[model samples]
Target: MGQKGKKIFGISWNVFVLGLVSFLNDMSSEMINPVIPKYLTDVLRTGELLGGTLMGAIESLSSLFKVAFGYISDRFRNRKVFIFAGYALSTFAKGALAFTRYWWDFLSLRVLDRVGKGIRTAPRDALIAESSEEGKTGKSFGFHRMMDTLGAVAGPLAGIGLLYLMRGIEIERAYRYLFLATTIPGLLSLFLILFLLKEGGQEVRKKISGVSALKSRNLRLFLLVIAVGALGRYSYAFTLWKAGELGYSLEGEMAFYALFNLMYALSAYPIGVYSDRVGKKRLITVGFLISALASLAFAYARGPGTLVLAFLLYGVSIAIEDTAPRAYMADLAKDFEKGTVIGAYHTVFGIFVFPASVIAGWLWQSYSLTYSFLYAAVMNLLAFVMMFWIRDKN
Candidate 1:
């Protein structure tokens, strides 16, 4: 930890800076994210199944690179380079969305953006884990998530505001301009990563196999449970689509999306701090239960009021989902293998994102959107049941 960065709310400087980096990047990402599903459906006219496939492919396909990049970082003992490169790639790729006129163009650019995510996420998380003081791990991660999700909250609101400003323009063109505008924040974040964020003092570089972490029985079983839980962790696009299905305008859906992020940002730090005291697995188990309930609520939501409740619950559930698992993995990992373990967790979670979103889409197209939510609900419950078998490390 750098001496200069140690003063922000008592966390080390690296954690704080990384949090800001995530904040800016997320702001850039979410500006487009809330609109992408609707854009695909309305503007590109891809329909439910194809739109879902494209979204899923964007998420899952790039995720395949996470473990590889993570291990490479571990081998090099250099997190900053990878982190910097990842953000740069995503920034440029996201900016290219302005030129996309077809779904394939959108998919290509989105996949490139996610590939950047894959490169950065694990190493960045591992860096956060390394930056924290021992018992404050949860606090550090929670604070980071709070900052990151604050960006998520801001991004949609910003997008809505930008759209309002550009209302006179054709909708598709307005969306294009918004995508191009996201590059500003992305570049700012990249600048922070390159200049301000500092790595821990270098160690004597050593060659090690990152995948060795997978040999632990506990890690393997925990990963299995995580995979199950991920099956229910469908994309937020589904929720956005639901809002549209229920007759909300684009701005209304953006408001709802902002609301979801608000709850997530508000709860993340507290839940993380609490998990440090009580137990991570307990809260993680609770998160699964909440996810199940939220999914069921989404299935039966009648109007805006019910949708509000569902989104709030879903937000808290996601706060936990986003924070605890990584903290827990950090707790479980050896100092040398933190990047590997965390990367494995991300890889496993992401590996399922495709099937989960696709399944939701399939259910939506073949039966009803109601069944899609029901499937998520059931999968969450199964994950909750499986949680009982895994022991918490810290």
Candidate 2:
């Protein structure tokens, strides 16, 4: 292994520590994510329109702040502070969710939770990138993703146990217990962020001019590709909704989710290694194609077999897209301004998701669930075409 490779992959303690932090944090977040829609619609008696609206608002709004917080971290030459504060804020949000009674209160807590996500995401990602060796970026990112998904796996299982415990309990009461359970892990994540992960000094000393940064042909093209892909990427809540539409029991839906995550975890590292070997663009294009087919299958699926196929394909597509895109960004980013570039990428990408989620929700509410799936399929096709236009020579 080269020095960078050896440094990043061989014996990097920081990678392990950061991965643990994400594992715990994601466990905290995922515990809430899959069940939130049920809580809103079934427990609180909120309409689908309101549920979708809340989800769309939280996702888009959270993305908007990722850029700002990322830039702030870059400018101040600090990563740990933002990371620590973000986790602390998230802990508070989880605690606040336990107290929510009305729809607006739930929405408020959701926004606060996403705000914490926005504040932490870019900075945390940048820190991971900084800690990695140059050539081994994909592996580093894949490792982090593996840990993140491990938490994702744990979260729903935790939710299942809580649900079992509260089997005869009121729905609101169940949520209260779930929220309280999540708080312990969230607080633990904060402690890890504060003490375990080492902070690296900012890589870029001088900020590039805003217009110039935007004008970078490679970056702009890459951002376009990401935005196009994101338009097809609806929220995971929609997936759970789809499972319900197929007459899945709560346990069955959770099992499918667990399977999806299992596939996702297994695929992430291999795909990341593949991207590093072949090229990010090729893998990304394949990812879009796979996602397009999955969306189509989702739209047309009639039985459990087809639904299982769709979910499996969806998991594979996530593996390809998630690992490749960040590695692509890291490849294109100027060494000095990686944080700014990534912040810009995420901010712009996020701008697209707000509309995508709202549109998906509105389509599902107005027409049919099939319409939402079809919409995603069409968007993925367009994204596939856009991917071919960009040159990966940078």
Candidate 3:
């Protein structure tokens, strides 16, 4: 039975608070994501030199940190401390971006922000899963993702507005103001998370064999396939880059990015709720199918108008993709091992993302956009086929 009036939208109060945290955090993040590549290229003078490769490298390193943070959180049986540190650290990263002068400066701030993300994500997800009522896991994760993407939508639109206001202003100057605006939301996120997040009764740490979390066959298969798929899904920095290559200005590209997030926000919860009713593995497979198709569309897009279609399809793929795989991984976890398993899954999956971006960048530089995206399409198709091996048992 539902919680009657005790809970909100079938999720616990902690879930709601965590979702609100993500909403504000993503608002701060998306404000900068759309403009990062452009800012590097035009303002920082690093575009032709280290653009995609460095973006990939920083993100990869951030993913690597998740392993350590996850292990520590499990070891201490404390999620709130790491989560508070993560949000606070990200808040610092956002404000620090106001003075970035070179590529390394940007890298340092971005990595710091991502470090916070890596630290908090696994433990936070474990908290949500553990707190959810039976049969509500998918919907809970979906609701959190919906709030997150809603912030993504708002952030980019806010950036677009700032871009217009700062038009005729120096590119770096405009971005500085954008950075300042994001800090407000960032600080709010930190404050809310600090006061609102709960650790509850801490569980005792269990001793498992070395890398014991990977002993489950279904979990192994799931992680491997997802990793393979992620190799094709390189830096989304390329998405904004492609839009600019097609002649859209920064504001225009941000608008499309907003559209992408809008579709994702609108669809994520519904898809998650549906996955709960149907099956997570089945919905995840369908996500792979949609992702393969969207990759192809991105490959062929020639104008902002075409990109509209691509982003919409990409949003559908993302909405379906976001909720299911992680929820399935959660389903496969032992009670005390959820954070570690989730971290391991993320570590393996993220290991390939750096190389994927490097390869995509090389193709974009040496080959063509079509080649770059088609490579991704093939990988997603492979992932789609691989999903069948997973049983999705709870």
Candidate 4:
């Protein structure tokens, strides 16, 4: 093992540093994430349909760039620079969101922020895969997800504290202060990526486009299954909105969102380790089933108790969905094509987020909130069926 291969508590040094980077970035991101929907509705006065459409469009549009950047990074054999640029761009966009008074400006800033995510995600995951010890890919991605979600857990709790501290301020100003403050952790994450993370010397393979990654039949099927799941996976903003619908105050809503992240943080690592032994496909299928169950819980939720169960189930489902799939993709890809394959996977999953969210919002605006969740449940059930058709052994 070279310098990058050295392990800290069984994780590669680069992987550990990247986890730290994500922890800080996610802390910044989640602080803003749980509040974005509320901010749009309460402050900017956007309707539910518009808010959800904007959120989905922000995610889907940026995600379209992943394959391009992933292929570029793979071609250049450089991950660090793309990773740094992406995070930096997002941090700037998020911080500037504090100043937006117009919905269009808000949408622009949000798209800029997600574009940063698109740029960084594939390269970052590929770096983690490259840094992992042999046969420990699942564990490596798991550790990264755990650290990332721990930051998510901390972010909302911090937001609750901040909101309390600013209880006397006007609500709009208070939200602005929160957005501005996210810059602190976002910048810290960039620091780690710039100074500590290292790119390894990867095998030289023949030049190929992102489409070349589609040669794997298993991967093609897996992408279809995940696309179905993505169609059902409404934005987390809906969860926060649910708390509002159930009559929770702002602090209560933040705490509720934190619980979801807490469950996600706690479950990711152990599940990752478990997948390493039992097989990622099995765990991933379970994740989709859990997501379906979570949707049903939300669809039928009558009060706080049902909401709690829904949040917990959704959290665990997301942990599995976010972690195991990447590791599974790593297992399938040639070493040289990790970024391209994972980027393609993310692209397929992300592209559907726009329509899913818009449809959910449309359901809420046109009929009822329960209908939106029911729609999600149906899509997840479809994905659950599709999962069994894959031929992968692990």
In terms of lDDT, model 2 sits at: 0.79
- Candidate No. with top TM-score: 4
Query: Distance (Å) between predicted and true CA of 98, model 2?
Result: 1.2
Going through the candidates in order, what is the number of backbone clashes in each?
1, 0, 0, 0
TM-score of 1: 0.96
TM-score of each: 0.96, 0.93, 0.94, 0.97
lDDT of 2 by residue, 40-100 (tens): 7887787666676677777777778888988787777777888888788888888788888
Kindly give the stretch of ten consecutive residues in candidate 3 with the minimal lDDT sum: 200-209
lDDT of 1 by residue, 113-180 (tens): 98998999888888888788777778888999999999999999999999999999999999999999
Better of 1 and 3 by TM-score: 1
> Which stretches of model 1 miss by more than 4 angstroms?
1-5, 202-213
All candidates: CA RMSD (Å): 1.8, 2.6, 2.6, 1.7
Off by over 4 Å in 3: 1-6, 201-213, 391-394
- Residue 217, candidate 3: Cα error in Å is 1.2
Give the range of the ten consecutive residues with the poorest summed lDDT in model 4: 202-211
Error of 1 at 49 (Å): 0.6
Error of 2 at 216 (Å): 1.9
- lDDT (10s digit) by residue, model 4, range 6-114: 8899788988999999999999998888888889999999999998898889878777888778778888888889899999999999999999998999999999999
